[model samples]
Target: MSSSHPTPQPWYKQFWPWFLIGLLLSSIAVSTSFAVLSIRSFDGMVQEDYYEHGKAINMVLAKQQQAADLNLGATLRIDPLTSDAVLDLTGDDRPERLVLKLIFPTEADRDHELRLEHVRDGRYLGQAPDNLRYRWYLQLQPDQETPTWRLVGEGRFPDEGEFALTPGRAADS
Candidate 1:
């Protein structure tokens, strides 16, 4: 007597084969996502002339030294209500125009420069844009010849406290 046997299903139809395929597909999906994200988000530093920039540091320091020699001091006040910035300067020479620089660290797009008007003797006033809330690197410079003096400081936006500016450095209130 001869016995008849049933044929087994193909590997493609089997559950274990499909499960293995699913795991491989999932791994590929995750790796592709990571690669896309890595390509999209990159640090913004792309300057190739890093050496030249480093060499220019000396010139910047020299300008600071000029400020130090001039005995420049300024008191900065920011109004919280209107966001208006006022600078009171004390030094030998009074500049006709003052250049105010507001630098937002890590965000170059937000950096601003305002030419302050001389309100009176030893007083400068400028209408800074309102609703600013961030840390800033403040640079107050006189509109003068090259190698002129400047005062540097750091402060939070909408600052109500008083800040004293020293040449090449910042002083806390």
Candidate 2:
């Protein structure tokens, strides 16, 4: 018999499948590791109780007489200036009344509450009493205790950019 061995396969042909498999495995590993690390980092962050608190606050607002008569698609905005809180309310329809509250945590209790008064042109104004500290939230409650009275925005007074409320954060509140 002739002394001959089968021709060796070329490196490209022989190793391509293995190389592709390794690349895929490495990509999966890297992605999995990245996801795990990201989840861990997220878990370590502070969880704001805004959503629960906000729902509770909305429930309270809805119960008020004002919210009962409000028209559809109404919206409210709370603008905290250097010294005062201004509420601007607008919608496809006008609202009969607007209710506002300053919500904050106190030294003794976590729930500190302050009520505000309607100003004009669907605007409401409130002063932050000395007892209420900075970082207090201004909540605009229209039609005071009605299911229609939704939370428009809530955030600290004289807002620092960091404390500005976002849709996601507000929803969680």
Candidate 3:
């Protein structure tokens, strides 16, 4: 007796076709999600005015040079419990107010600028943010209509204890 062959299945009813379709759909869904994320969130790395920023780089470096020339240095201590920031500045340049900026690495919106009042000696008093924690870049400059010099440092907040800020790189070697 002859064996009858089974009926061939259509593409829609085949396992291979369904599996391929699932993979394609999954990839499309992933790409769509990525597109949405790109539209919704900012990367914060790109500057809108690249030419202007490039031009300003020299000015910034000049400020750093001024700091170095003035022998500017600072030790900053923060008390998270009391939201107090104590700054001991040492330099030939001493202003009435010091501008201290706690900048979050990736988020410009999270940056906080505190104005420190100059007290007796080299001590300056300022209020730190209550929610200070984790990594932060500290920028210390004299509070002026136009700041001429600046010092930079990096440390973790809340547990900062005492950290020193020194003049960063200058335009000239």
Which candidate leads in TM-score?
3
Q: Each candidate's lDDT (Cα)?
A: 0.81, 0.48, 0.86
Ranking by lDDT: 3, 1, 2
Name the lDDT of candidate 3. Answer: 0.86
Which structure is stronger by lDDT: 1 or 2?
1
Clashing pairs counted in every model: 0, 14, 0
Off by over 4 Å in 1: 1-8, 46-48, 144-147
Residue 142 in candidate 1, Cα distance off native in Å: 2.0
TM-scores, each model vs. reference: 0.82, 0.37, 0.83
**How well does candidate 3 score on lDDT at residue 81?**
85
**Model 1, range 92-115, lDDT digits (tens) per residue?**
767878988888888777898887
Best by lDDT: 3
- Tens digits of per-residue lDDT for model 2 on 58-87? 556553334334432223333334445444
Stretches of candidate 2 off by over 4 Å are 1-83, 93-96, 105-114, 131-134, 143-147, 158-173
Candidate 3 positional error at 121, Å? 1.1
- Of models 1 and 3, which has the larger TM-score? 3
Q: Residues 1-173, candidate 3, lDDT per residue (tens digit)?
A: 99999999888988998999999999999999999999898575567789999999898889889999999888889987898899999989888999999889777789999999999788999988897888888889988889999898887866747878988831111
